[model samples]
Target: MNKDYFKLTGEKINIEDLSREIVSDSKDEEIKKELYDELVPKLRELHAKLFAEAKYGILVVLQAIDAAGKDEIIKYIFSNLTPQGLKNTSFGKPTEEEESHDYLWRINKGLPKRGEIAILNRSYYEDIISPKIYDTLDSLPDEIKNDPELWNKRYKQLNNFEEYLDENGFKVVKFYFHVSKDEQRKRLLERIEDSTKNHEFSFSDLEDRDNWDKYQKAFEEMLNNTSTEIAPWYVLPADNPWYSRKVATLALIDVIKKINPKFPEFSAEDKEKAEKIAEQLKNKEI
Candidate 1:
C-alpha cells in the first residue's frame, strides 16, 4: 500500500484543493470489490488475534458531512469482525445530560475495553466543528463561548486526550470522508425522490445545506489542528464509495498489522495438560 496516498498525519490539508473524486491511482470499482472480498477474511483473523491477546484496544472514529457514506463504510468493513469483539456507536445531538458534563464525557464512556474494537460514527470532534459552524456554542459559559482562543484550546485538549489514550494502549484511527457538494446534492436528492429512503432525510440536514461553506472551513481547521501522529486522520475521497472503502480497509489492515497482536502462549505445564486432555477426548475417555 502507498502510505502517503490518503494519510494526512503531518501534512497541511486544504479541503478546496483535495479532490472528492477518486484519483487515477485508485483501484477501479471491480478491483476494489475484489480486493475488499479478499481483505475481509484477513481482517477477521487479525481481529480475532487482537481479541485473544487482550492487550491493545482499537478505536475507529469516522467523521463526515451528511450523505458521505459513513454508515455504508462501517457496515462493509466491519461485517466480518467477531460480534463480541466489536461495538459501534453513533453520535447525533448531545442529550441534556451530556451537555451537563464536559464535552469528552460521553466519548470516554464509549471507549473500547482492552482487546476490543470500537467504531464511533461521529465523535468528540463534532464539538469542535459542528457547534462552531452552527453557533451552538453561544449558550456555553462566556469563557468558552467568547474566547477567541477556544478552538486552539480545544485542539490542545484533544491532542492531550489522544496522547493519554496512546500511552494507555488504545490506538485511535480517524477518518474524514471528503464528499463534494455535487455528490452530496445527488445523494440528498436520491433520499428525497425515493420513498423508501425518505426516512433517511432529516429536516436539519436541509438547514445544514445553507452553511456548506462554513462547515467546510470548520472541517479544514479541525483536520489541520488535530491530525497528529498518534491519532492521524485519513481524508478519503468519498465520491466513489467503493474506492473509499478499499482505501479505508487497507489503512485499517496496516494499523492492525502494526499492532501485531498474537495469541497468548501457554506455560509448559499447561501445554502438556492440554495435550493429555486432547488425547483423552480423542479416545472418548474421561
Candidate 2:
C-alpha cells in the first residue's frame, strides 16, 4: 500500500548498513517472521498482475558469491508464482562448446519468451570475472588481447546488446545478492559440517575461493560498467536468508509495479459479438 514502495530514491544502501537492521541474534525472530508474513502476500498479488498483464516479460538476473543463498532465495521469493508463467534457468560451469562462442551467445539463448517471466541464476558477468581471474584471454595473441581498444569494443558490444533487448520490450531487473566474506565462510563451513548440505558443495568452489578478492574486484567493475537505467542492479544484503528473500521479493515487485503493464484490450467489435452471444442465450430459442 505504500506509494513509495521500491523507489530507489538514489539512496546508497550498503549491505553492511542494511545487515544492521536484520535481527541476526535470537531476540529478533518475531520481527523477522512478521516481515516474511507481510512480504509474501504482496509478492503474490504482484505476480498475479504480472502474469495477467504478460505483454512484457520480466527477466530477473541473480548474481552472488558462492554460498550466498541464491538457490534459497529463488525457492522462497518466487514460491508463490505460478509455474505456467515463470521460467527459471541456472548457468553452470561453461561447457567446451559454450567456451568456443561469444560470451553473450550462451546467455542470449536463455532470454525470456513473450508472456513469461524468466529468471537467470547467474548471467553474462562471467566475461568480466572469468577473464580477469584466469587470465585466459592473456593467452590470445597480442594482436587481439593486448589491445585496450579490443576490450573497450567488447564492453560496448555488451552494452548495445542489453540496449537492444530493452528496445524490443524486455523488462530487465538484475539483483546482486550481496553477501559478506564472513558470512560466506560460515556458510561454506556449514556445508562441510552438515552431511545434508555437503552435497551442495563442489570442489571447484575452493578454486573460486582462492580468487575471492579478485572476484570482488570483478563484480564491482561489472556492476559499475553494466549498471544502466534500463537494467539497474540492486545489491541485496544476503547474510540472512530470510532477509534476502524479503528484499528480493520487495525489489522484484517494485520493478513490476513500475512497468505497470496493462492486459491486452479487446476491440468494440469483439464486445458486440460477446453481447450477441449472451442475448441468444437469454432468448433460449435457438
Candidate 3:
C-alpha cells in the first residue's frame, strides 16, 4: 500500500477528494489471498512476540460513518488475534457517570495494558462529531456550543493525549473508513430491504444521513486537526470491503513490524540449570 494515498498527518483533507474504491473485483481476489496466506499469519506471529516481550501496546481506533465496514475489520482481522492480550471496546452515548468526568476520562480507563492490543470501535471522537451533528451537549456550559474555538481545543487535547500514550511505549493506530455518500445510501438501503439485514437498520441512521454534509465536514476537520506524527490517521476507501481490508491489513502489519517486539532472553545461570536438568534426565532414562 502506498500510504500517501490515505495517510493523513497535519495535512488538510477534503472528504470529496478521496476515492471510495480503488481496485477491481478480480484484483481483490488476489489481495484477499495474500492477506489470509501471508499478512494475517505474520500479524499473529508478531503479536506473539509482542505478548512475550510485555513491553509495548497497540491501540487501534476504528472510526467511521455508518455501515463503513468497521465490524468486518473486527470480525476478519481482530478475531484472528490471540484473545489473551486483545480487547475490543465500543463507545456510544455517555452515561451520567461518564458525563461527570472529563471527556477523556473514560477513554483513559479503557486503554490497554503493556503488550496488549485494544480496538476501540467508536471512540472519544464521538464527543466531537456526534454533538456537532446533533447539537446535543451533555452537562456542558451552554456557552461551549457557541465557542468557535472549542473544536480546535478538543483536537489539541486529543492530540496531546495520544502523544502521551506514544511516549509511554504505546502506539495509537487510527483508521477512518471513508465510504462515500452514495455507497452509504446503498448499504443503508440493503439494511432496510434485506430480511436478514433488517436488524441493522435504524431510523437514526436516516436522520444522520440527512446531515451527511455536516458529518463530512466534521470528519475532514478532524482528520486535518488531530492526525499527528506519533498517532497518524489512515483514511480507507471503504466502498469495496476487499480494498479497505487489504489496505487495513497492510497498514497493521507495517506498524507491528515497526514495533519489533522480541522474546526475552534467559540468564546464564538459568541456561546452565536447564542444561544440567537435561543431562540428568538423559542419564536417568528408563
Candidate 4:
C-alpha cells in the first residue's frame, strides 16, 4: 500500500487538479467487492480487538457532496459488524437548541466511547463548510462572522478539537468523497428520474448545485488547514462509489493497523480463577 497515496503531500490542493475516478482494471463493483472482501474481515478483526482492549476508540468522519454515496458506502463497509459498541450518527442541519451553543457542541452526541467505533456521517465539519456556502452563522457571535479571519480561526479550532480527541484516545480519520461536477449533475438527475429515488431529490439540492464552486473552495481550504498528522484526511474519488469504497477500505485498514490494538492480557491469578470457574460450569457444579 502506498502510505501517502490518499493523503495530502503538500500544503495546497487545487480541487480542480484532483481526479474524480480511480484508475482500475476491474469493473466498479468488482473493485470494491474483490479488493475489499479481504479487508472487510480484517476491519472486523481489528474492531474486535479495539473493543476487547477497551482502551481506545476511532472516529470516522465522512464528508461529501450531495449524492456522493457517503451513506451507501458506509453501510457496505461496516454492514457485518456486530452493533454492540458501534455508533452511526448523521448530523444534519442544527436544531434551535444546537444553534444556541458553540458550533462543536452538538458533536458530543455523536462521539464514540472507548471500546466503540463511531461513524459521523456529517460532523462539526458542517459548522465550517455549510455556513461558508450559505453565508449564515447565527450560532456564532456577530463579531466573529464579520471578521476576515473567521474561517482560518475556525480551521485552527477544528485542528485543536481533533488534537484533543487524539490526546483523549479517540483516533480521528476523515474521508472526503471527491465527486466531479459532471458526475454530481448526472446523479442528481438520476434522483429526479428514478421513481424509487425521488425521495432523495429536493429543490434544496439544486440550491447547493448553484454554489458548487463555493463549496469546493471551502473544502479545499478546510482540507489544507485542518488536515494534520494525528487526524489525516483521505480523499476518495467518489464518481464510482465502488472504487471509492475500495480505496476507503484500504485507508481504513491502514489506519487501524497503525492503531494496532491487542486483546488485554490477564494476570496468572485472574487466568486461574477464570479457568476454575469455566471448569465448574462445565462439570455442572454450581
Strongest candidate by TM-score: 1
> How many angstroms is residue 171 displaced in model 3 relative to the true structure, after the best TM-score fit?
0.4
lDDT of 3 by residue, 1-286 (tens): 6866778778877788888888777887898888899988889888888888989999999999889999889998888877888988989888899988778988876688988999999998898898888877748886875788888889989999899999999999999999988899899999999999999788888888899899999998889889988898999989878878878777877888998888888789998988888898999952
- Clash pairs, candidate 3, are none
Q: Which ten residues in a row have the lowest lDDT in candidate 1?
A: 23-32
Candidate 1 lDDT over residue span 1-286, tens digit each: 4756788886887889986876554557675666566877778889999999989999999998899999988777786788889989999888988888888989976799988889999999999988877777755899778999989999999999988998999999998999988889999999999999999898788778889999899999988999988999988889978778877877888889999999999799999999999999999997
> Clashes in candidate 2: how many?
0
Over 4 Å off in model 2, which ranges?
1-36, 138-142, 149-151, 264-266, 272-286
How close to the true structure is residue 30 of candidate 3, measured as C-alpha lDDT?
Answer: 90
lDDT for every model?
0.87, 0.71, 0.87, 0.83
Q: Which stretches of candidate 3 lie over 4 Å from their true place?
A: 143-145, 277-286
> Model 1: runs farther than 4 Å from truth?
23-28
* Clash number by candidate, in order: 0, 0, 0, 0
Q: How well is each residue in 8-114 modelled by candidate 2, as lDDT tens digits? A: 33344423343312446463465357556776776666667677776677888888778988788777667667677788888876777887776777887678876
Span of 10 residues, lowest total lDDT, candidate 4: 1-10
Please give each candidate's TM-score. Answer: 0.95, 0.82, 0.93, 0.93
